[model samples]
Target chain A: MPHATGKITARELIDLQSHLMLESTLVGQFNHFARESTDPQFGQLCQKLAHSRTDCLQRLAQHTNITPIQ
Target chain B: MYQDQVTDKNLCLAVINQLKWSATCLTGKILECEDEQLRQDYMQLLNRTFAEQKEAFDLAHQRGWYQPMMADQQMIGQVQSDTQKLMMEQQQSMSPMHQMAQYQGIQAPQGLNNYQQSFTNPNLQNQSIYVGGGQPYYSR
Candidate 1:
């Protein structure tokens, strides 16, 4: 029911894009941390975090249907 | 040597710190966001990130990577006493202002009192000055 018209302002679109970018960047950082970790458990923890952030990124991207232009 | 010093604990700490900052950034953005839908969406993300950050912190604590310092009883008592002292000082400072306000409520202001007195003043009665006119204008 929220945003029933599905219309987004330029400012909203920019915010969405920035959120997506931050999420993506977090995912990359977690992935890198996973690889850099010496302990297997720590690596798995980073992987889980990365996956969670990815899910969040995907959810926001799908909700707003906006992605930052490369 | 620096690379060698990087351990699992250090890596976990790094991730935890990053998550903490990310949550803070999201909070600020959500506060500033004007759109209703965007605010709601970002609020959800912020909650999730905060939960995940807590999880990371717990894991680190369990593994002895992050040991939060526990406050001693003496320190706790000192803080409580200091806070009470500050409260007492604030109340004391406000007492004079409160008394002044109450006193003012019962008395007319000086300016109003002077203006009221001016109308009843006998010396100023029937006194006026000529303003480039042949006749003097009397004021009562």
Candidate 2:
């Protein structure tokens, strides 16, 4: 529980965590969009984005030592 | 590549400005907040924004776009100490029931119910939980 003094406070870590959580949510939304999308290119882009987000989620999990709720 | 840097700088600036505005809004809200917990929440948000501004300033300084005046080290130390004290005080304000709930959370591990129960019970204080190392059962 190292608190913030000058560089990188716990609050900032929490904020980073919050941003990652939002990203995960957005990725889920994109996945749903991709499923519904009729255009192959758009669907492919969404699937690629979802994979990228999964990688980001893994990195975020390593940083925070906490599993994402979803 | 050049365009990327410009875009990044613009994004960083936007984020910094947004944080600054949010901090101002929170500061005003904090002053008007009647509930103690709400006031504390606002203050925490303000502190977070201040931290974000500091980070953005550092990034700008690193890129040689701008330099910030160095803060007094002693003043920073005082602020850190005050924040720690406040956090400790907040933790102390929790009721005994809440404390017990927190304890239960710590003790509730998968597949170690019996082992956890043996160590966590009040009557086992006299008996050494560890076999030989004389270390406490709990790492914390």
Candidate 3:
């Protein structure tokens, strides 16, 4: 079982949290750039990046068994 | 397993700093764009991203991984007033300054503080921060 013995190391916890924040921030940056872009294609590119980050965040959330506190 | 050997706090700081930089660069890009559809798309992405990042920040602060200095109300108020003044002067402002004026005021404590005390309370730790030994839960 993951986190077997129900004991998660500080490293793992921090790693997870850092990744969560990183992805969350990336999503915002991607969107911000997309908003400023003139090419619809650039917007599409940002869409892809944000979606990718969101998926990573969701997966991280699942692994940690906690909904991100907003 | 993490990719580096750095301390958790250090890693969090590094990651947060980089994220902040990325956001700054994007903000510049957003301000330079004239395309409506593209702007709308970026706006949506920023909205979603800002929300998610807020959560991450709250979590970090809760865990003692980060403690941003408390707000200086005088400076904050001045900045807010200046922004409002600018917004008033240029009702049809095409700059991101206008968009920034519309963003939420987060320098003041209110939303996240409501639940922050719980995370810091030692008694509440058993229910919030740590789960079954040291298993991290980051419960909201």
Q: What's the ranking of the predictions by TM-score, best on top?
A: 1, 3, 2
Measured against the native two-chain assembly using Cα atoms, what DockQ does each of the candidate structures obtain, in the order listed?
Answer: 0.37, 0.02, 0.03
Query: lDDT per residue, candidate 1, B45-107, as tens digits?
Result: 888888888888888988998998999999999999999999999999999998877665556
lDDT of each: 0.77, 0.55, 0.55
Best by lDDT: 1
- Which candidate has the highest DockQ of all? 1
Candidate 2 structure quality by residue, lDDT tens digits, A1-70:
1211223334545554564565466467557656765546445645655665566456444434433333
- Name the weakest run of 10 consecutive residues (lDDT summed) in model 1 chain B: B128-137
Stretches of candidate 3 off by over 4 Å are A1-70, B1-5, B71-140
lDDT of 2 by residue, B1-140 (tens): 57545343454454456446656655665665544443454465467557756765566566665555777999899999999999988778766768666665555534455565455756545443332222235422
Better of 1 and 3 by DockQ: 1
Runs of candidate 1 with Cα error greater than 4 angstroms are A1-14, A63-70, B1-4, B70-81, B101-140
Give the per-residue lDDT digits (tens) of candidate 3, residues A5-24.
Answer: 34444545554566567668
